[model samples]
Target: MSDTFDAYDDDGNRYAVPVRRSYINTSDLSGPGRIEGLPSFHLSGGGAVNRIDDQTFEIVATGKRLTVRA
Candidate 1:
């Protein structure tokens, strides 16, 4: 997956369906390289938080990873 790593669109033009991404941040309430909690809090078989900005949140899996308190 490397047509010279294509993904430019600002008058450059390049998009041939090449995809490969990754992200697994726990959430320390910060930004970038985030990893704090959620190893097993609440998530039976469906787990997905998905939010990279505005506080930050990224917890995805087959299951197990979701917590909340005060």
Candidate 2:
């Protein structure tokens, strides 16, 4: 099966997205002095999944950070 799942935005918008696992790659970055190769989900509707921590994930769409549902 694929890593696609349902995620919700801050406005309670549901989206079917695909999860991208983290690895030792140089393609993912958050900032100039930060690393962002964590496990994230790609939303088909818009934006991306930003990993806040081990047990927390957020949706970043259109420059907005949204909460995810468990």
Candidate 3:
């Protein structure tokens, strides 16, 4: 699994923010594995998750501080 981040309005309205994307290997999501190559935004604090489309998704991580845009 991977993660990504986007800015949203206070009313939960998504805006045009730079879409940050990261890639995590399959092994990373299997069991208890470590995820590498994360961005600084994810490293700050709480992460986020969003549904991009029917088959696509965005996972933000608070653990390693990274967002995987899948």
Candidate 4:
């Protein structure tokens, strides 16, 4: 089974998780792009989420690292 998690910033802002699309799963060309109710690691603006440990993550963008709670 797959586990779902929510990611939150230090200030308690919730990020909308995105459903990843790949070449093998391209049949649904016009479906909802985000996974609701889950926290997003991929920032909507820019940046990538890095796993620090269980329940903790780091947002890296523009040479800055911000803490994220997961």
Top-TM-score candidate index:
2
Q: Which residue runs of candidate 2 sit more than 4 Å off their true CA positions?
A: 21-40, 45-47, 54-61
Once model 4 is optimally superposed onto the true structure by TM-score, how far is the C-alpha of residue 11 displaced, in angstroms?
Answer: 1.3
Order the candidates by lDDT, highest first — what do you get?
2, 4, 3, 1
What lDDT score belongs to each candidate, Candidate 1 first? 0.32, 0.60, 0.39, 0.50
How far does residue 37 in candidate 1 sit from its true spot (Å)? 17
Clash-forming residue pairs, model 4:
none
lDDT by residue (1-70, candidate 1, tens digit) is 1111222233443322222233467556585574333232112223334434333233455322222211
Provide TM-scores for the models.
0.16, 0.44, 0.19, 0.41
Quote the positional error of residue 16 for candidate 4 in Å.
3.0
lDDT of 4 by residue, 1-70 (tens): 1233456665666764333333333336676343334344555544576666565666666333344342
**Candidate 3: worst-modelled 10 consecutive residues by lDDT:** 61-70
Candidate 3 to truth, TM? 0.19
Q: After superposition, how far is residue 66 of candidate 3 from its true place, in Å?
A: 14
Quote the lDDT for 58 in model 3. Answer: 47
CA deviation > 4 Å runs, candidate 4: 1-4, 17-41, 44-46, 62-70
Pick the winner on lDDT between candidates 1 and 4: 4
Residue 18's lDDT in candidate 1 = 22
Name the top lDDT candidate: 2
Give candidate 4's error at residue 28 in angstroms.
32
